[model samples]
Target: MPEQSKRLIQLLENEGPMSIKRASAKLQVSERSIRNYMRQANAKSTQILTDHSKIWVQERKPASLDFSRALPQNYRERSSYIIKKKIIEKEEVDLFDLSETLYVSYSTLKNDIAKMNQEFHAFQVHFRLKKDKLVIFGEERQIRKLISHVLAQETATHIIDMETLLNNYDKNLVHIIQQEIEQIVVHPALSKNDLAKMNLILHLVIISTRCQENGGCANDALALVFRTEKEKQWFGQLIDHLQTRLAITYAKEDLEQIQVLLAGNLNFRASEPSFEMDQKNIRFTSQILDLLEKRFHVDLNREEVKELFLRHLHNLNIRAQTGGFIKNPMKESIRQISPTIYEMAIVMAVEYKKYFQVLLPEDEIAFFAIHISSWIDQSNALNQKLKTLLVCPAYLNFQSDLLQTLSTRFADELYIPHVASSEQSGMDDGYDLVVSTIPLSTVSSQKVISLSPIWTPYTQQALSEKILKIKERKKGEMIRNHFFEYFQEPFFSVVRKTSKEALLHQMCARFNEKEIVASDFEKSVLEREKACSTAFGGFAIPHPLVSSARETKVSVALCPEGVLWNNDQKVYAVFLLAINEVDKRVFLNVYEPLVSLLSDEEFMTRLSAQTDFHAFSSLLIHKIK
Candidate 1:
């Protein structure tokens, strides 16, 4: 076998899978050359790979180690990978010898080892002595995980490379593994991107392959307590397939972990026979929908949302029972784009803790956010869209990008009727609102709202609010002036970090400085929150239990990071009410409509995207109206 062929095989065994483009780049060859090498690996080195040997056999296989290029530049760059491979191979190394190889002093190598010892120990791996030479020990399974994590960190792409995980860490079965997994899962609702499914499969391969190699027996660490009769039958069939196909006997724990991965990954499409839903899952799903309806006033009990949640909850509960995890590729995207949904996910975390007695990880929370975001999009689709006109500068700008973005985002909410350039300034187009980049004094038969060029979160909020206001005013219902009077924009702020009490104190201090509330306002608010959670759909409606403020005012804060509201809920948005005795009715009138709109899944999605105070206030008034 050629050196490239051996390298290709080794890479596949250790990493998992890679695209032809990536493999060519990693190997410093053309994609065509890589393919030829892959073919050679199968034909010539078949017996060598069967042994699962990590050593380079020069005669049997001419693919000897090319040390100079393979070894990374420095200890800082190569230490982890080198150490991991050495440990996996059970190769002992003396400090003095490693110092010579790495071109560093013995003391420096000692210090690096000491630092690494502390770090690897966290993952249940230990660097200790074996036959008077430093080597790695501890749980072999965890050691493999630590190695996988390190290699994954090296790649910049989202793809998880499968390194011969199924081939005893030696052969390529990327296509076969993917196909087998799809057949096994057979869930229709698998993520549209399929990255989530791949992630699930990658984790399973890592754990299962390592466990099997170690002759790992059944461990109850992550086994499910409850399973439908059908799930049990299905799980058994799947395990048998994996064992027979991969040529490894899976222990009870190995089978259980695979089940946990699949269960928590609710990417399953609906079943023909209707899944035997868990009783606990049904209760939890009902509670979640009930909470959404009570808090957001949106009925997500539709066939799709209900079915999706049940599928997700099936795994969520199992994860809740076993503390298993499923990586969400869209975790960061959901956090950045739909913070409100992310907070709702945190709320699920809190709620899950209440019933299941275990907290779901953020990735799991993001899985929940995926469902909520989808529901919001689908719900919004059924609503009436607003008509608007875009007014850009005389010169061509990035207006088309802005239009496409806004249209895509607020698909159901906004419809751009015409694109009017400021130089021409035609106002008779009869649009619901004129969103002008430049200030336009006159726009007959339409509302004119000047926006910034970048279409920042602030501008998006402003545009959304303008459309809502037009609709609200047509009802002869004045929700704007009262809101503008009570909710001070200067008092409003966007917080990245802060605790619940600390945030409350800060908001109360602002009100005190402005002479809007009494000294005990923050205390009373905390007490109220303790009495009952103020958070609903990621927004907390915390206020004094009794009316005792100087006036009826709302002090608001948006924390995208989400503050822990109590032991259960985390809130991203805060609405602090300070209502006086005379304005008691004002609280009921404003609070009811205010919380209802803010709690609305669609509205929260919109609000979380806004980046400015004007945009924030504009949306508030529109929703209130």
Candidate 2:
């Protein structure tokens, strides 16, 4: 079966039924092609069923996929196959044999090897062909790290477990390792999530397989040290269990690397400081907090928050030093949930790279973001609560009951300081929300919610929805007030078609000519774009990796013909933001709402069709209102 058909089946199984038109749009195929894919997929197993104009999965019966016979079809898959053969499977392959198996030309196979070498540069590993036979050479530690990365990329769309493990590893070996991990005792502060535990089992299997095949990973540079006796005891027991169960012995360096991996994966949250933390960790934590304050205007220097941060930093430092980092499975979800917190985490990562000269992987960055988000949540809970006014008419003294329900439900979200009758509601217009039993004739400008005197599930749900809308409206209003200030007429353009680099260059040149941005602004923006595309929901938000603009300004480009932002994605609109240091907070204030507004695909499609800035901006402001 074609790869697209398998992907279509996976999509339907994961994301429920979708109309043919919607599926075609999402898969970047024609309606006819979608139907063809459905037919091909259904012919294999009859799992895909179509009802009217929609397709869905009836059941996901496992298919006996013979990976050995199925040759890799793309550069990514071919590279993964080659790496797995050399590293995990410990097999050497002749170039001619591989070319014949992959159905590629000899020269093409050599070119692929060159590309793999280039990609492997960062991991300090490389592939070399000795007399047309492929062999991999690198530090054992680096080799394992590369294997972890390759495994992650291969199984990105699926869960990591026995079923997935069987695709690449020996089933009996995997089960043996899993059984041992299940028998071992977990630490108190370690994560007990089944997924994390499964990941540990997978890595241990990788380590044992490699060591058993070749030899122990012995490096004199790594010192085996444990901070506390609990950690030491834990490490000793784990190694002893693995050695006894597997009939193998591990080197000190392998033990050290294992300890680092444990620290990276299992260290979820900090408890009381087991021993006095190091001064280097203390200094790094203080610097990060100060940097967060300076860049985002966020002060996370409270004693409790600082202490937790310091403890996490201790583990982070260990990973940096030992060159063993765990991959985060929830990295994408965390990034999508709170982009603002993730952005703050990126700032910390940049500082980490500069201070430690070790680049933290995206997984490690996501883990650090967990800590920062918790601290921010704590600070927001204590300091920021919506001031609410409850207005219920005097009817059997039921106003008290209604207020009590609200206070209990939204204790952390709302602060109800005043209770007034409908007639007395016009006296105060200062609260963020006005909840009333009776309709208000006046106070037209206030955010008013009229509900039943008796609080029911319907009323509670309505109030919850209203509170969310109120928050978004206030956030939208903040950006709307200064919308014109950031988006100026001179910075607006209507382009029939353009490339990302061309558009960025034109805008950055204009800004540079007007002395609005530094000369290196375009370079920074391009670097950031290459690292991660800013395109989202048919629009792109391109910004610099670092803020050093003379003045903060937003440039808008309406590409009615659609400019390609990334592979398989064309952006109809581009929002290029050049932010100054002093105006960083302003950027944060508007970034979320701006993304939210542009994320409306239908609205953006219509708005981008407008030829003039006046029409586009007007439609945008009206929508925000």
Among the numbered candidates, top lDDT falls to 2
Query: What are the per-residue Cα lDDT tens digits for candidate 1 across 571-623?
Result: 77888888765445434555666766877877886786677789987776656
* Candidate 1 segments whose C-alpha is farther than 4 A from its true place: 1-476
Residues 508-529 of candidate 2 have per-residue lDDT tens digits of 8878887777688899999999
lDDT of candidates 1 onward, in order: 0.58, 0.67
lDDT of 2 at 96: 88
Q: TM-score of the candidate numbered 1?
A: 0.25
User: How does residue 379 of candidate 2 score in lDDT?
Assistant: 45
In model 2, the runs with Cα more than 4 Å from the true position are 1-385, 392-408, 421-425, 437-442, 452-455, 546-550, 580-589
Span of 10 residues, lowest total lDDT, candidate 2: 60-69
